[model samples]
Target: MMNLQKKKLYTLLALVALFVILFICNMLLSPYHMRIINLVGINIALVVSLNLTNGFCGVFSLGHAGFMAVGAYVAAILSLPLVKKAIILPELPKWLGSVELSFLPSLIIGGLVAAICALIIGYPVLRLRGHYLAVATLGFLVVIQVVITQLQDFTRGARGINGLTQYTNTWWVWIFTCITIYVVWRIINSAYGRGMMAIREDDLAAEAMGVNLTKYRLLAFCVGAFFAGIGGALWAHLITVVTPLSFSYDRTFSLVVMSVIGGMSSITGGVVGASLMTLVPELLRNLEVGITVGGISIPPLYGISQIVLSVVLIIVIIVRPKGIVGSREFSWNLFKKKKWNTMNQMEN
Candidate 1:
């Protein structure tokens, strides 16, 4: 116990150090590098929240983009200045025009709205398993996109909300990133997390053991959605825009890939995976454009990042299907066997 406590303390100190380092980077990095760092932080929040639902609860959801859309639009609308909102969304009710909020409250409202949506959908949606669940969630994403496109007054139709304030900074993003990590860590160390794991291992057995599948699944889904909402809000403010296309199928695919590449079963996996996926492709993005280095006039590589990432994904799938840190924590512990009492408790 003492050793475990020491480990915990050391981990906290290490995270603090990292936070400080990032804070320093925020101060010193060029705008482009700063943008990349901010994006990495946002991806970390998104991928980690995704890990909570798809990783821990054994739910293969693909509609996280829907939650993100809800969050981004909601936060954007709320945080936009009243005059701007009136211009962009001229069809909105007059009362809504009077209700502009600060950035933090907008983000909280966005997260809450997304969580409520998750709870409403998850109750019935979680009943499905495997690919069916994936399909249903994908359907949800499609629905959200359509709705956003149709709700011209609310979402500004296809053009999307634009020219907003840049409320998201390195500090706001990393703060939420830390919150996401802390919340996920607390959940992972809890009984619900154990039950969710049991469900992942074998839902039939978990059900037999009274693991209250619905409750735990919804818990994970809602929590995950909430943070995803927060991430979407951060993205919107950072980009200073929100649109139907902002949270698309492509976004969902990348996030899932991030979770799988990092380690579906580990919290640190989300961080590593998010960092790797975000940074590597961005670092390679310049290669896609033609550059006149030393007057050589090199042609554009065209999809260099995609090709490299595909190769990496192929390697990961072939060599480590569970991911680089599969079934392990930051300590790099070797794979360990599990006992079955994890999900034996369930309230009927």
Candidate 2:
């Protein structure tokens, strides 16, 4: 119990320190670079949220993008200027057209909308196990895509919705990222989180031990959807546009890749993986090879960074299936304790 308390305190302190550093960086960095960092932060939120269902609860949900779309559209609509929305979405309900909100409130409302949708969807889909669940969720994604496509008045259909104010910044992104990481870390260390882990480890055993399988699973699913929705809102605001295709299978695959490469069980791993993967392609795109080495000029493949990253991910999975950080979390004690003990010894 003492050790657990100590570990918890250490974790809290570490989180605080990390947030402070990220906040400072956000303030100091240029908008362009900050945008990249913000992308990493948002991806961390998305990946970690997905891990609740995929890693802790042992559910395979390929339809997180659906929740994202719901959030994006909801938040976008709420944040848009009344006059501009009137011009773009002329047929919108008067109530919706009259309402406007700041970024944070819109994000929360978006999350709530996504959570409600998840609750409704999870009722039937969560009953299926393994591959059936995967397929069912994939179908849900398709259904969402179709709905977005058909919602011509609200979503702008295939033409997509644009002219959104770019309100998201590195500060907002990192603040939310820290909140997400801390919230998830707290949950995973709590009894509810333990129950989810138990279900993941052995569903039958967890059921036998009096864990409400359906309730916990649905809770995890809802929480995951809520955060995914938040991420979507941030993304929509950052790009100043909302498109149905942005939340399609390709986007889902990228989120899945971050979770997998980071090691599903490791929150730190997820954040690190998301950051690395988000930046790598951009870095590759900017690389200029003007000189030839050994008479071989390095041609830029443009799209080859993704392929290289994918191959590297495959090799890592084969070699260290547990991911880069495995289940290890950041520990201030590990670094601070030794120095403290040495100081004591020297004084003695």
Candidate 3:
């Protein structure tokens, strides 16, 4: 017990130290670097949230982008200055046009609205399994995007809502990222999570074993939606815009790729995948710009990031089908096991 407590203490201290260093670095780094890190943190929230449904719960949902869109629009509208709201959404109802909120409240309200949306959508859609469910959820995404485009009074149509306050910083991103990781990790480690995993493994078997399929699946779906919404709100504040284009199929695909590459079943994998996905495009920016070496300039490699991502994804699917980490969660036990093995080898 004492050893476990000590381990927890050590982990907590290490995380605190790491955050301190990261905060310091954020202050020191260029705006580009800060933006990248902030993006990574937002992706972490997104990847883990999606991981809850698709990975742990074994639900194939393609509507993450849609939920995010809901959150982003709601939060942006609430947080937009009243004067700017009139200018941007002149057609909005008097009640909505006059309303303005602080950042945190807007963010929370956005997430809640998304959760409500999930509840409404989950009733009919959660019954389907496999590709059917996937298609259905994807349809929801399309429908939401279309609605946003049509509702010029509410969403400003294709033009979207801009001039949003930059309420998202590295601190906000990482704070939410940590909360997402903690919440999802705890839920996955709980008995209800075990039930969800059982459903994933075999829904019929899980049902036969007395696991309530509808209840648990809805729980996971709604929870996942809630966090996705929060992530969307964070992203909206970061970008200072809420366009339908921002939450398109491409965005959904990116989240899917992050979850898959990181090992959807593992929280640590979510972080790893999100970090890699966020960093890779930035790291490859030179490819998008001409590279000059030895007085010879090479033409820019447009779309190279996509090509690299595809190639890497294909390789991972072929070689490590379960992902970089599979279903295994990272632990200090790995180090302990290694030390024990080393001692045994020396004794031998």
Candidate 4:
């Protein structure tokens, strides 16, 4: 227990230090750099939440983008100024139109709404397994995008809500990212998590052993949807717009890539993958315009970043089919094991 407490202390201290550094960087960094940092936090929240269902529960879901859209539109609509609501969404009910809210409540409400939707959807959908479940969830996302497009009074009929208040910042984004990580970690280490993994490994055996497949699956799905909603709220406020185009099938595909590239079964893998996917593309932006090498004028290589990044992803998957981290997590215990191994080697 003492060792556990010490590890907790270390983790807390590390988080404090990282937060302080990020807070300082938030103030000092250039706008572009700040945006990148903020995006990293948003993606962290997203990819980690995704890992809860897709990774821990071993469920195939491709509707994360739809969940995000639900949250983004809900939060964005709520947080918009009363006047903006009146102008942008003239069709809003009088009660909703008249009401205006602060950021925190809006974000939470958005998440809850999304979770409720997920609960309703997952109840029946979770019964399906394999690619059937995948297709079902993906269809759900497609339906959501279509509904958003049709809700002209609420969503401006595909133009989307615009000029949203900027309540998202480095602090809110990263603090939520930390909360997401903690929540998923706790879930993973619980008995319930073990049951989920059992179901993943062998559903027939797990069901025979009295593991509740639908219950655990739904729990993971709802939890993941909740956090995905929060991430959507963060992204909406940061971008100051909520458009149907923003939360399309492509977004889901990219998130899946992040989960797979980092190791879908590992939380740290999600973080690493999110960081890599977010940063590498942005960092390589210069390659799009042109690169002057030793006074040699190189023509612009438009879309080069995508090509190179795709190649890198392919290589990573070819080398590590289980993902970069496989099923392993990054923990301090690993260092102890390494030290003990070295000591034994020396004695031998």
By TM-score, the best candidate is 4
* Minimal lDDT window, size 10, model 2: 339-348
- Order of candidate numbers by TM-score, starting with the best: 4, 3, 1, 2
lDDT of 2 by residue, 78-175 (tens): 99988889998888888988888999999999999999989999999998888899899889999999999999988989777899999888777877
Better of 1 and 3 by TM-score: 3
**Cα RMSD to native, each candidate?**
4.3, 5.2, 4.3, 4.0
For each candidate in turn, the TM-score is 0.91, 0.89, 0.94, 0.95
Model 4 lDDT tens row, 299-329: 8999999999989999999999878877777
lDDT of each: 0.87, 0.83, 0.88, 0.88
Better of 1 and 2 by TM-score: 1
Backbone N/Cα/C clashes per model: 0, 0, 0, 0
Better of 2 and 4 by lDDT: 4
Candidate 4: minimum summed lDDT over ten consecutive residues — where?
339-348
Return the lDDT, model 1, position 68. Answer: 95
lDDT of 3 by residue, 69-105 (tens): 9999999998999989888899888898899999999
